[model samples]
Each structure stands twice: as structure tokens, then as C-alpha cells.
Target: MAVSMVGTNSLYTCLDMIDKMVSVNEGYIAKAILALLETEKCVVEGAGAVTLAAIMEGKLPELQGKR
Candidate 1:
């Protein structure tokens, strides 16, 4: 099987930092994709789900309760 890689080189540094902060593993990615499919009725690839995964994993606690 051909393994596909996610994420872009332009955002690699930022993504790496977020991954470290939130532990963006396969499980979180899977949950993000499932959530998009169920709620938005659309399919999203791994790169596209990174932000959602971070949010779902609650990595941005600083943004909590801020509008």
C-alpha cells in the first residue's frame, strides 16, 4: 500500500509545534475526519483536519472563553 503523507511544507514548523503541544496522533486525526463527515457531510484529508484535531483535542486552552 502506498502511504500518503499529510501537511504542507509551508506549515510544517507550526504544525510540528501544535502536534507537540496537543499530541496530534492517528486517533485524533480519525476523529476529526469523522466529525467533518458527520457534521459537514464532507470528506477531509489528514492535512485538512489538523486544525480540527487540535481543537477536538483541546490543545488551545488559552482561547477558551475568548469570544
Candidate 2:
């Protein structure tokens, strides 16, 4: 419906700005959370841990060996 479409403008805008998209499953998210909690002593929620999950799982190959 026209009314529901209003909220998706931001999603469209974001899509315009990105060149690539990647994803990780719940297991990867869980592992990232455990790694953070054990190694960094930090408590983070699933959404907050997603980027690190992608990195830890090698989803972002561009970041490899870049310090």
C-alpha cells in the first residue's frame, strides 16, 4: 500500500549508498558475542555485535591484513 511504502524510503536511500551486502547467521552472531564477552569483557546485544560477527567470520575480506 502507499501508506506502508513511506517507511521504506530510508532503506532505498541506504541501498543507493552501498556497493556490497553480506550476512551472517545466528550461530555466527552467538560466537561473536561469546568472543566479545570472554576476550574483551564486554556485554553486547546481537544487533550491536553483527559487524564484529561479519569480521570474525571473514565476511569482509577487504579488511584482512589491514591492521
Candidate 3:
């Protein structure tokens, strides 16, 4: 299980993701990922905090396995 966000497109856009961060009473977290790929348009990657998607802070490591 890889712990990170993986994408092929050149998503080079960073905005205020504050609103995207949501908290649940069940002790779970969620965030929205908006990226501007080279092709244009915006891509949204919404994942839970426990998943690798939440920890995808530009630098993704251990592509073969989880950290």
C-alpha cells in the first residue's frame, strides 16, 4: 500500500486548502486537492486523512510500498 498521491499529469497549482480540511466527529479528516494540469482544467482529489492521499505534500516516497 503506497502512502501518497500519485498522478501522471503535471499538476502545478497550489491554493489555500484550508476550507478543504474537514473534521468529523468520528475522528476522521478529509481534504480537497485542486490541481491545474498542463492540459488545463482542475482536478480534484478528495481522500481521507488516514489514506495516502492526505499525506501527499508534493513529495511522494516509497512508490513500491507504504511508509
Decreasing TM-score order of the candidates? 2, 1, 3
| Number of the top-ranking candidate, with lDDT as the measure | 2
State the lDDT at 52 in candidate 2.
Answer: 81
In candidate 1, what are the lDDT values of residues 1-67, reduced to their tens digit?
1237545774676775554444576788889999999999989898888778777777867655554
Model 3 agreement with the true structure over 1-67: per-residue lDDT tens digits = 2436634343233333323432232222223233322223545334333333333442234443564
lDDT of 1: 0.74
The Cα error of candidate 2 at residue 34, in Å, is 0.6
- What TM-score do all the candidates reach, one by one? 0.58, 0.72, 0.19
User: Which of candidates 1 and 3 is the stronger one according to lDDT?
Assistant: 1
Error of 3 at 56 (Å): 2.9
Evaluation by lDDT, superior candidate among 1 and 2: 2
By lDDT, the better pick of 2 and 3 is 2
Score candidate 3 by lDDT: 0.34
Pairs that clash in candidate 3 = none
